[model samples]
Target: MNAVPFRRIGFDIARDVLGKPDILLLDVRDPASFERGHIARAENASPINLGRFLTETPKEKPVLIYCYHGNSSQAYAKAFSESGFGEVYSLDGGYEGWATANARAAAAAPRLSETLKAFLIAQGFPPDDVNAVGKNQMTPLMQAAHLGPAALVAELLAAGARVDAMNSDGSQPLWLACVGDDPEIVALVIKAGADLEHKNVNGSTALMYAASASKAKALMALLEAGADLTYENDGFSALDMAGSRECLDLLRAAQRRLKAAS
Candidate 1:
């Protein structure tokens, strides 16, 4: 009984909805993930609560729904819209987008720090162009993901930097986050939609680079993001390049789970 399709909105639009009063902000993630972190004032769509929400909340109210990576929320949003709720919307990029959007809001400084700004200028990039191509054909965001204090990365992302932007070799920002071995930055770009399955011109993925470089935290982040444990670069899988016993065990366990599921 679907009517019009629900709109899928980015964080920017969601932020605007948040500013308005009486909007219904719903998080459809499992209870544990919702407990870990969720947008302020977001209601978890547990069974009993969802039933109550549908029958009780006024259809005049705008509804914004979100799930893990912004995928699952769409179904829920459609259901709501079909039920005749006006202004129903699904969040694009889900909880990841929400987390990064909050971080960006909190990271609002006047501009890049004097040191980082000078460094970017010295490297021949305009500090104000967050997406300007620079050394290695990298965007400022890619550079910051590689060289992060988290805030700089957040700020650049706030300025509309693309997480999916790739250099000539097709290496996304996520690849450089692993090279920089910064797990926080790795997670940041991931939430921002860094492609897990992206294969560069060399057939390498961020997961492969993380394992090869002995970047334990970055590797863990990729695994948690559900990266394919069986990915290979010319027959050299991440397992072959694992730098430590801990990494090896993680890859093996994840691989086993993937096998078991299939």
Candidate 2:
């Protein structure tokens, strides 16, 4: 049998803790220690319950593990690697090192308001921080889609905002763009990799929104982007939601095309 390989990352290099969407932060410390303070969004899964934790976490996602001083974390990291995790890392100095360096920065990094967001973006703020959620769990990109200047939406997308990020209502930025009836914004989001088939809490998709709102250009863009025509929400498909004759015609044509291809 061979030992699994994993990386050991120092506090300095691990500064972008929450930036990666697929990175899972695991704090394998005592419950009391975790309760006192652990990294933001880090899950506490003590060694005693390691098996259960591993079962719940996705093996494909990168896992960063930390313990009291770092020794215990190495064992956990190795365990994750051996269990088929693609990327595993042990924090070099563990929680003590991170807290000493990042506590203040993390605490001070407030969610930006739309006005402040615009100001900072104008001043060249990093786009990766666009994931920062504000009121109603709306990411900066979602806010931009809602408030637009379509250019701002494009800027955020260029900065690597996750196009599929859902708001409190499970509405993604693409859905909001459709709701706003901004064809340009809808196109920008689709170009930036928005999920055309993403459904909200009510199971209504962006295509449905575009059709219902009579957004001809947006509906056309979605169809071109391969939005699923057969997707039904609460028994209503995009074709059923088409409010205008033009929208209905487009959806029907698309449905026929898809049916023929299948």
Candidate 3:
């Protein structure tokens, strides 16, 4: 059987794929090096058991395979491909190469905005705390929504922040944006996979809060994303919380849209 030549991806591609919940990565390096710190969501599978792994690995999805160095596993890529695995790749220089490249990026990373940087510092965060999930289980994305500005939210997202991160209170970035009543921020969070039906500690969804505040724009944004207006948290649906006729109108329109879609 003719083996397909493997493509070697760099750290950037690897980092991008880390955001995907379904992507599988196999680190063929030894167990000791893996425990120190490996790529996010990467699983260890050494060259010693290459045949066993190849036999069991799902051939449907693409698998990024790597070792400490590229030498040992380069041939496994060919072996996997010959064994009917659809897509297989080897990291060019391996984990060592990835570590060196990441170090350079870390060293060269630019300074963030003075105000937001100061806020993070005041929160007792280290220099690398931009996207770090703190002990409070709060991500910078959630913090930015509580603060303000498209800038802070954008910066954190660029720094690998998870948009749908829920705080200890179960309040996601979307909930914060709704509380801020910023329509643009609401849209941005929605695009980032903000949970429309997520309930906070008070058992209230973003739509319920928006309805309470009579924020028609924010309410409409959530509604358009298939948010359930009739979905009750505690004893009230968003429509029931709507104090004004406009809020009720928004809820009715959302109901119409949902009905149409289904």
Give the 10-residue window scoring lowest on summed lDDT in candidate 3: 15-24
Candidate 1 regions off by >4 Å? Answer: 1-116, 260-262
Per-residue CA lDDT of candidate 3, range 161-260, in tens? 6665556676778887877777777888888777788777788888898899887778878877777767787677888889689989888877777779
Angstrom error at residue 177, model 3: 0.8
Candidate 1 per-residue lDDT, tens place, 1-262, comes to 4566689999878766654445788999999998998776688996557778889999888899999889999989988888888789999999987777656754663456676676568657865546556545677777778878787787677666777766767788889888887778888889888789888878988888787777888899999999987777788999999888878887888888888989
Q: Which ten residues in a row have the lowest lDDT in candidate 1?
A: 127-136
lDDT of each: 0.80, 0.77, 0.72
Model 2 C-alpha RMSD vs. true structure (Å) is 7.7
Model 3: pairs clashing at backbone N, Cα or C within 3 Å = none
* Candidate 3: regions farther than 4 A off: 1-115, 122-124, 133-137, 259-262
Instruction: Give the clash count for each candidate.
Output: 0, 0, 0
Clashing pairs in 1: none
lDDT of 1: 0.80
Model 2, position 56: C-alpha lDDT score: 83
Enumerate residue pairs that collide in model 2. Answer: none
